[model samples]
Target: MFTNPEQFANATKTLFELQMNTFNALTSKAVDGVEQVIALNMATAKNSVKGSVDAGMELSQAKDPKAAMDTAASQVQPAVGGAVAYGEQLKVIIEDIHKEFTEAADHHMAEAKNTLSALIYDVTKNVKPGSENAVDVIKAAIDNAFKGYEEVTRATREAVKTVEQEIAKATAQVGALKPAPKNEAAE
Candidate 1:
């Protein structure tokens, strides 16, 4: 539909630049997310190693087998709590990354759709008198494509929301973990 080579080249260049920008933004987000995860892992690992060494020392200092067993048993609740905390922290990181990625993608998609629609409009404006039907057909096809894209995006968002809800529920349950009452354990 382009009337001139120059116009066509310009449009192509615009599209290419938009796509490259989107790609770069997404890549940066991914790198940031990975860095956050790595930092969390490193911190968790250090704490875990320290906790293990302290627990070992306590167990070793026990005067009898029963004391040693009791020392080990007391460590269970803290270990579970630490694990739950770590999971929650990881979840937060992942959710943040997801939110940022979704925003970036949505922004890019909107920009692309607008740009393409404008380009199409510009190209169709100088149509030959007898080519009105062809222009209409082209416009209809583009409209339908955009509509389909919208529907898919909506469904995907709902799916992600449901998944996030489930994760929250699971995390809550894990966080609620508790050791049995001392009386009950004694029985």
Candidate 2:
């Protein structure tokens, strides 16, 4: 449809504008979700440690060590509660983001596919029965589309693997660290 340079430039500009808007909105949502998660985690971690130690000290004054430990255990419940809340909140936020991103990607993918389809159609519409150029162009477009699909898939897999590895490493580090004692949990 964009036969002239001017029309092509305008179309490109419009596409870029739409892409920028989508990108900015996605980034904003992601940043807000991350910030909330970080804040919630920090607060929970702080309170869990502090409550464990303070309760431990208060309970330690009691004559029974087991009862004192039980009391301290009851005091350090923020982590579970916070994690539950964070999980639910983060789930919704992440789902919303995924929906937005998927919708955007689908829109672009469909458009690209359509454009290629139309280009091939146009090229073949008037070609001689054995036109070499038409066959070559169609083959090239198909190959390019397949390459693009594979690249996107590979990148997605790598990103998922990287995130999983980082999560595992963090978990291992936390597990390796010596847990806080009844009196020194926070400190």
lDDT of 1: 0.80
lDDT of each: 0.80, 0.57
Give per-residue CA lDDT, model 2, range 62-151, as digits (tens). 678787776766654544454455555545555555555555555655655565565555545555656766567655755576457446
**Candidate 1 to truth, TM:** 0.77
**Which candidate leads the pack in TM-score?**
1
Question: Per-residue CA lDDT of candidate 1, range 50-80, in tens?
Answer: 9999999999999999999999999988888
Worst 10 residues of 1 by lDDT: 144-153
Any runs in candidate 1 off by more than 4 Å, and if so which? 130-173, 181-187
For candidate 2, list the clashing residue pairs, or say none.
none
